[model samples]
Target: MTISLRSRHRWFSALQQLAQSIPYPLRGLLLGLLLWSTLTSAWINPDPVWQAFAPESAIAALGKLLFNGTLWPHIGASLQRVAVGLLAAIAVGVPVGLLFGLVPMIERSASGALQFIRMISPLSWMPIAVMAFGIGDLPVYFLLAIAAVWPILLSTSSGTAAVNHKLLLLARSLCATRSETIRRIVIPAIVPQILVGVRLAIGTIWIVLVPAEMLGVSSGLGYFILDTRDRIAYNELTAVLLAIGIIGCALDWSLQFLQKYWQPSR
Candidate 1:
């Protein structure tokens, strides 16, 4: 029985290693192929009604969109919005998070209200955002910022609270000013946590971006999707959906790489 268990474990470990060794791009391609195969098999006897959804049509549409530079403007607009929203979140969340971490009284006082606000979905405020900001990119920015800020604030506060007491004590012993200590020790100590917050914020922002863009925005991936649907271009719509997933994945992978790269050397 012991030998059998050992052999099973060994086999599992080998399989895991083999899977890990496969390149990410190759894995993505394999997944795409599997999806393509499934779709092809499912639609073997496709009716006219389902012709727009054919895999070949989608592939052709994707190729045309890529080759003709038709998709670049929408991609750029979405990226710009994401960048602005992320920056706003960092600016607001980091300072407030630091305050919460450093002052227990303030945190206690505001915790309930903060949690209440955080629990509210960003999308729920869409009508208010549109009414207050009056369309264009402003309302979209507001929504994305709202969606992103909570994760950043929470992560930053947690990181700050978990900072080493020994380090703080050392700074005190050295008669370091509060600003000096924070600048030299606290910020550096919490960098990994900040990156974590940024990563979370990015994910939240990306998710919110699509729906937010639907709110009277003239340009963006979301707008493109609506346009395609209105035009009865299902193939183009599918291609855009694929693009969104690919871009989001790339953004996440980039952040993960940055987080790993920025970790303090042990």
Candidate 2:
């Protein structure tokens, strides 16, 4: 009994030291580890959901999928849609955002309509998208663009409105033309906000891409998920879901690195 108490005390002390070593935000990871340990004991049966997450089964599924050469194309297709949709959103959103920001009258005139459209969920337009664009990348692109544009537009407009009035006055006093003022001062001032908006838009676009891809597209992670379900490949389905989560996290982290590296404050 004394030896067992000593072992428990040492274990708790180690855990306490670990908790103190890491940041508060990552402490949840310790909880997740505890939950995983408990689940491992309870997951002895080959229940599809439990077995799907078993590390050995997950690894096997990943290996089989990779060896079959069936995975890369879906990932590539989804990435292509994301790239196209993000670019389109940025192209149209930035100019409109700038216009809305610089001109209060225009923003005021369009605010109600913008808000109304913004409130409409992108998924709700799936049927109309298919009917209009007719069952292809076009429909998926339309949904992604609609989902991503609002954040960029709103952020750009807010950033533009928040530009320092005194700086603008200084530019005007120096006889700077409107175009020069915008090019030099306005664009530079709002770049941080633009990056933030892009980050937000990227996250939104990635999320919408999955379900949007399910709209009759032949190839994508979403389609693969459906395929796995139809074929009853639950382990592979779980592997794909895990892959999506990991890839999505990687993309978000890459964007965060860009934002931090390019941001003025360092």
Q: Assess each prediction's global lDDT (C-alpha) against the native.
A: 0.89, 0.87
Best by lDDT: 1
In candidate 1, position 184 carries an lDDT of 86
**If scored against the real structure, what TM-score would every candidate get?**
0.87, 0.87
Model 2: per-residue lDDT, tens digit, 72-144? 8998999999989989999989999999999999999999999999999999999999999998899999999
Candidate 2, residue 159: lDDT: 96
Q: How close to the true structure is residue 131 of candidate 2, measured as C-alpha lDDT?
A: 97
lDDT of 1 by residue, 3-99 (tens): 9999999999999999899999899888987777566554564556465666677778888998999999999999999999899999999999988
- Which residue pairs show collisions in model 2? none
Model 1's TM-score against the true structure: 0.87
